[model samples]
Target chain A: MPHDDHDHPHALLPPEPALRVKALETILTRKGLIDPAALDEIIDTYQNKIGPQNGARVVAKAWADPEFKDSLLNDATSVVAELGYYGRQGEHMVVVENTPGQHNMVVCTLCSCYPWPLLGIPPGWYKSDAYRARAVREPRKVLAEFGVTLPAETSVRVWDSTAEVRYLVLPMQPKGSEGFSEEELAALVTRDSMIGTGLPKVPS
Target chain B: MTRVHDMGGRFGDGPVNPESEDAPVFAEDWHARALAVTLAAGSLGQWNIDISRHARERLSPKDYTRFSYYEKWISALADLLVQSGVLTEEDLRGEADGGEHALANRALKAEAVAGVLASGGPADRPSNVPVEFEIGQEVVTARPAANRLVDGGHTRLPIYAAGARGRILMVHGTHVLPDSSAHRLGEAPEPLYAVAFPASELWANPEHPQDEVVLDLWQSYLEPE
Candidate 1:
C-alpha cells in the first residue's frame, strides 16, 4: 500500500512486493548502504540462534526450580540474560505468572513489539489487525479461537505492551507435569503458551 | 492523531491464522534482508529504535496497513537512509552507480553480526529524576483538553487507553520515553508504570467485565486521581 510513486523518476518500478524488496536491496548494496554478507549473518542469528526454545528453557527451569522462578518473576532481565537470552526487542523483560484464577495474555496495540531474544520472532497472528484490536477487547474469545478454553470463573489479564518493556507469560504448570524432568518440561512449552494465547501442552 | 498502527479495540479485520510452532523465522529471503538492513542501518547510531519505529508508523495509512511486516521494515529503511543523507533518491531508484558516496562509518560487518546481536543494546538507563508515581497509585490518563481525545506526534499512549482511569500495578524504573526519543529530543526518561484498568472501564458492555488490561504507561501520560 506504500507504493505511491509521487516523486519517483521511474514509474515502471517492479510491482511485486518481493521484487521491489530485491530491487531496493540491490540498490542499497550497490550504493554501499548495506552489506549482503552481514545481512546473511543477521538472518542466521534470528533463524537459528534466537527463538522460543530459549524462552522454553527459561520456562522449563522455572517449572523445575522454585528459586529460579522467583528470580524470573522478580527480575527477568538478569535471570534471562544469565542464560544468554538478552538482546534487541528484549532489553526490558517482565514475566507474568498465570494462576488458576487468572490467565495472562500479551498484545502490542501500537505496532508489534515482541520479545525477540526469548521468543525469537513473533507469530503472524500476533501482528494481525484482528489480534491487535480484539485481544484487549475480547481476550476470552481470542483465546478460545486459539483453542484455549478456560473456566468461567478465571479472570483474563491482557498485557498491552506499550513501552520499551517486553512480557513473557509464565503459564501454570500443567497437572501431571510434576514428574517430568526440566528438559521434558521445556518440550511441552509451546510458543503460544508463552505468548498467553494458548495453554502449555499437557502430557499426551 | 490516532494512526492506523494504533489498533486497539477496533474490530472486524479478519480471522487469525496462526502458524505452527516451528514456523520459519522469515517467510522469504527478502524479509530476512529487510530486517538485516534495518538493523544494520540502525547500528550507524544516527537514530534510535524508537525513531525507526516512528519512521514505519509515519508511512501513509494505506502503506502502513498494506505493507507486510517486513515490507514496512524495508520501506522505513529506505526512508531513514534517504533522510539521514546516506543515500539519495537516485540511489533508491537504482539509477545511480556505485562509488558515488562514502558509506556510513558504523556499517555492520559480517564478522561482527553475531557479536553485535548477542551483546544487544539495552535501553534501560538509570535516571536521576525523581519518579512521579508509585505502585498501587490510582491515576487517570491525561487527555487532550478540548476534544477529550489524544492525537498527533509519535506517542506511546494508545487512543483507547487515553483518558482512562487505572491503578498502577508496578513502577518500572525510569526509561527513555518513545515519544521524545523518536524525535531526537533527548531520552526524556521517566518512570513507566504497568497500569491495570478493568476491562469494563476500557470498553462499554464488556464481554469480560471482571477481566483487567495492564498497559505500560509512561509517567507523562498519567495524572494522579
Candidate 2:
C-alpha cells in the first residue's frame, strides 16, 4: 500500500504575476475578446506539440542524409517545412552549421526572437539581460560559462536575430558515431546543442 | 536616442546564467497563460506583431529592467488591449459593466489554433525599387545626428549597430519594413541583407579577434561606405 504525496497541494495560491494574469484573463473573457479554450489550445501547442525535439529530429536527419544536409544549409525554410515543421516565429528559417574552424551562435540582442515552431518558446536565459548584452561582445567568454570552451583558433560567429529570420545551429556530430541510426543520433541531440549554447551528448 | 531595450554590447550586465537542461517551457503556470493570451489577442487583428514589439519596447527603463520576461508581455498586452479598444481600463479594474462586444467575432477559437499556428503571417513582400546594395559590398548603417533617434518610433536597428561599417553577406529578399509597419503606415517592403561586421570594427577592443557578428538589416538602414 502507498500513501498519497503531499508535496503539491490543490490550492489557489496564485503569485503576483499569476494574479495579474488571472485578472487579465477575466476581463478579456468577459469582453469576448479571447476564448479560454483557445488559450488552452495555444498553451498545449507549445507545451506538448512543439519543442526542441523537432529541431533535434531535423538535425539527426541532416546528419544521416547528405542531400538533406545540403538542402538544409542552402534552403532551410523549405527543407524544414518538408518535415511538417514551419510556422510562427520560425517562418523565416536559417540553419547555420557549426564546424571546428567556425562556431555559430544565435542571439536576439534587441528582443527574444526564437524559432518557436522548431525550438519552441525562447528559454529564460536566452531572454536574460546578461546573455543579450554579453553574447555579442564576449561570445567566447559566454560559451565558457555554458561549459562550451572552444579553441582560441576557432572563430565564434554570433548571429543576431535582428529581423524576421530565425536561426538554428546544427552542431557537429561526435566521432565514432558513423554507424549510428537516425533515431539514435536524434536521441543524442540536446536542446542547448541546437541553440549553440551546448553540444550534443556523446554516443555511449 | 538609444532605447533601453537595445542591450547589445552594453556593460555591467553580470555573468550569464543558463537554466538547467531539462527546464520546462513555462517556469510557472501564469507564464503559459500570459503567452497564450497575448498570442490570442494578437490574432484579433487589432495590431501587428511589430506594433506589439514596439509596445514592449515603450516600457520605461526602470520598469523594463525590473519586470520579468512574461511580466513585460502581460503588461504590454494589457496596454494594447485598451489602446486597441478591445477592453477598457475600467473593465480591467472591475469598476464598469462589460459593454457590447465589437471585436468578438475576431476571437480565435480552439479548433482553429493548430491551423492558425501552422499558417504563419509571412512578412516577405515584393518590392518595386531596385536593391541598392549587393553581396560583398561594404556598407554602413545609418546614424542619426548626435543624440537623435530614428524617427522616435519602432525600429529594428539597435544602437550598437548604428554607424558601424560591415560587409554584405547575403541578399535576403524584400520584406515588410518594420519601422513603417509598426506605425500602421504601410508594409513598405525593401531589400533585406545579412551584414557581417568584424569584431574589430564593431568594438574598440575585440575579445575574439577572428570572430564576427552578423545582423539582418534593411536597405534603408545601409549606405555605401
Candidate 3:
C-alpha cells in the first residue's frame, strides 16, 4: 500500500521522465560501482542454488507419484520440503491446480509482486505497466500473445495476486517422460508450463 | 499473509512480469545515494514494517521514482542516518574522501537489498488515490470520467477496464494517491481490491460466458455491484 497510488492530485498520473532515468542508470554502471557482471552472477546463483529449478524438482516428484502430487497440490510447503528445497519461499507455497476445464494466469495489478525464489527472475513483461493494466482486462488475449491459446470452450480465470497467496501451475506430464529420471523430467518442465501457457508436450 | 515476492500462488494464470525489469532512469548524483536509502528501507520492509516512521524522510516524489531499484535503497539509508543521528552529510562526504565509505559499510550495503519497495511505475509520476473498501466487497469497474484531467496532476488509474464490476479481494498499502484512475472516481482511493474479473466482463461474447477472471482494481476505478 503506497501513498503515491492515491496521493497524486491529478487525473491520469503524470508521465515520468523515462528517458532521463535510463541515462542516469547508464552513468551508475559506468562508475564501476555496480559489478557489471553481478546481474549474471545473481541469475546463475538463483538458477543453480535456488529458483525454478527447485520448483521443477517439486513438479517432477509430483508427476512420478500421485500421492506425492496430491500432497503437493493440497499442502505444497511440507511436500516441497520432503524434496529438500528448504528455507526458500516455497516452504509455504500453495499449488493451484490447472485442469482441462480451466486455466490460471498470475498478475499483480497493484505492483510487480512475484515469487522470485521458486520462479527465478520474472520475465520483463511481468513488470510492464501495459501487462499489469491489460492482464486484468484481456487475459485470454495476453495468453494468446504468449502462444498459449486455449480451447474456445474452456474458461480463463486470471488470478490478480496481492500479497496473499503465491501460485504455481501443475502442468500435465509429457507422454515420453515415462522412463525419464527426475532430473530429466524436471528439465522438461519449462517455466512457461508452470505459468499455465504451453503444455509440456511429450518429448519427441 | 503473503509477501510481495510470493506472487506465484495467488495469480491463477501467467506470471506478472515474471522476469527482471530494466533499471529505470534516475539523475546521476542521486542514483547511488538513493539506492542506499531505498535498500535500508527495504531491509526494514522484509519484516513488513515501514522504516519511515523511525527515520527522517527526505525523498521527494521525483527523487523517489527517479532512483533505480537499488538507488532508492541508498537514499533511504542516507536519510535514515541523518534522521537517526547515526551519520550526517559531512560524515558521508568524509567517509567517501577517506576511502572508508565502501569498506566501512560493505555489510550494510549487502543487507540493503532485503526489503525493496514494490512501488511500480515511475516514482515521480502521480499515483492513484485508492478509494476505501475491504476485500470481498462488490464493486463495478468503470472508465475514468473524461473531465477530471486538470492541471499538472497525474492519476495511476488506468482507463482500460471501463464499465466493469468486481469484488474487493485486497487492500494494499497507500502511496502517492491518484485522485483519478477510474470513472466516477472519488476524491481519494484506499484499499485497492485485488479483484477477479470474469472473462465475459472484459471481452465481448466470450466462448464461455460463465468463465471468470480476476484483476486488481483501485477503489477509485469501481462502484458497488
Candidate 4:
C-alpha cells in the first residue's frame, strides 16, 4: 500500500518516474477512476499475450504454405484475422513480400504507428527519430546497420506507414528451411526480420 | 502545417540504436502503468484514437522529443482527462480531496482485457461513397503552399510525400480520414490508396532508382496527373 508522497516537504527520494506513476495510480484508485487489477491485467496482456511471436507465426505459416501466403498477400486483413491477430492499429493489414529482387521495410515517419496486434509494441529503434527519418531516405544503409546486407541488384522498398493502415514485411524464406515444422520456422523468424530490419535465422 | 510529428525525410536527427532481441516489453513498471492509464482513460470513449494522437502531437516541440515514448502517453492522458472534464489539475496534483466518485460506465475489466486485445478495433468500415480514383492511375500528391505547409490540422499526409508523383498500387475501400475523425469534424470517409512513389522522385540522386516508397494516402491528398 506504499505510495510516493510528493507532498512531503523534505522527501529524500528525488521523484523518480516509477514513484510518480505509482502516486498517480494511488490517486486514481482512490478516486475510483481506474482499477488496479485492470491495470495489472493490461500490463500482463501486452507483456505476455501479445508480441513479435504473433507476427513470427504468421511469417512461418506463409513460408510453409503457398496458399496461405497468397491469401495473406491478397487480403491481409482477413488472413491475419483468421489467425486471431486483428485489432487496433492492425485493423487494415497489408503484407509485403520480400523477394530476392525486392526487400520491404516499414516505418511510421510521422509517429510510431506499428501493427500492435501482430508485433506488439514497436521496438525502441522503430519509434526513434533516427530510424523514422533515415529509413525512408536511406533504407539500404539502415538495413546494413541491422546486419541485413542486400545484394547490389536487390531493391529495398520502404513503406512509410503514414495512415491507419499497418504493414507487415514478409521476409524471404531462408534456404535449407524446407523440412522445418511450422513451430520450428516460427522460432527462426525474428521480430526485426518481419520489420525488414533483419533476416530470418538460417538453418545450421 | 509542417507539424513537429511529420518527420519523414528530414535529416540530422541522430543514430539508429536498436535494442537487442531479448529486450523486455516494458522497460520499467512505470512504462506499463503509463500504457494502462492511457488505455483506461481512452476506454471512456470521449475521444477516438486520432484525437489521442493529436493530444500527444500538441505537446511543445521541445517537450514532444524530450519525453520518452510512454512519458508522452502519460502527458497526453493527463491532458485529455482535464480537457474532457474527467479530472482537473488539482486531481492530478493530489491537491483535491479523494472523495468517492462515480466510476466510468464503460470501465474495462481485467477479465475483458485479453478479449479486447485479441479482437482489436478494426478501422475499416463499409462506406457507400463511390471511389474517385482507380489502381494503376498516375497521381500527384496535393502540395500545400509554402506559406501553408499543413492541411490546416492533424493530417496523415507527410510533408516529404507532398507534391510527389506516384502510381496507385491499390485502391483501398472507403475509410475514415484521420484529419477529420481526429477533430470530431465528421467521419469524412474517403478512398485510401497505396501510392507508390519512385525512389528517384522522393529523393534526388537515389541509391536505388528502381526502388519505390509506398504510402497509404487518402483520396483528398491526391489529384489525377
Clashes of each: 2, 0, 104, 2
- How good is model 3 by TM-score? 0.55
lDDT for each of the candidates? Answer: 0.82, 0.86, 0.48, 0.81
Model-by-model DockQ, in order: 0.59, 0.39, 0.16, 0.44
Per-residue lDDT over B1-225 for candidate 1, one digit per residue giving the tens place of the 0 to 100 score:
457788899978766777787777788877777778778777767788877887777677887777788877777767766766776777766667777346544668889887888777676678877888878889998774111221345788888887899999998888888877877777878788999999888898677667999999888788999
TM-score for each model: 0.94, 0.94, 0.55, 0.92
In the range B138-174, model 2's lDDT, one tens digit per residue, is 9999885122223567788788888899999988899
TM-score of B-chain for each predicted structure, in order:
0.92, 0.95, 0.36, 0.92
Docking quality category of candidate 1 according to DockQ thresholds: medium
Q: Residue B186: error of model 2 in Å?
A: 0.7
Give the range of the ten consecutive residues with the poorest summed lDDT in model 1 chain A.
A1-10
Cα deviation in Å at residue A127, candidate 4? 0.8
Query: CA lDDT of A79 in candidate 4?
Result: 93
Model 3 alpha-carbon drift over 4 Å, by segment: A1-44, A86-92, B1-41, B44-197, B201-208, B214-225
Evaluate residue A99 in candidate 4 and report its C-alpha lDDT on the 0 to 100 scale.
Answer: 90
* Best candidate according to lDDT: 2
lDDT (tens digit, per residue) of candidate 3 on A1-204: 224333311111112323332333233333333332333333334434545676677778778888888878767755665665444233235576677787776676645545555675455466554566566566666776676788776676766653234567787787768978888888887776776644664677
For each model, chain A TM-score?
0.93, 0.91, 0.72, 0.89
Better of 1 and 3 by DockQ: 1
Q: For residues B1-225, could you state the per-residue lDDT of candidate 4 as single tens digits?
A: 556777877789867888998999888888989889778767666788877887777666775778788777776666666666677667877788998666555667778777766666666677776788888999999886121222446788888888999999987788888877877787778788999999899887677878889999888888899
TM-score of chain A of 1: 0.93
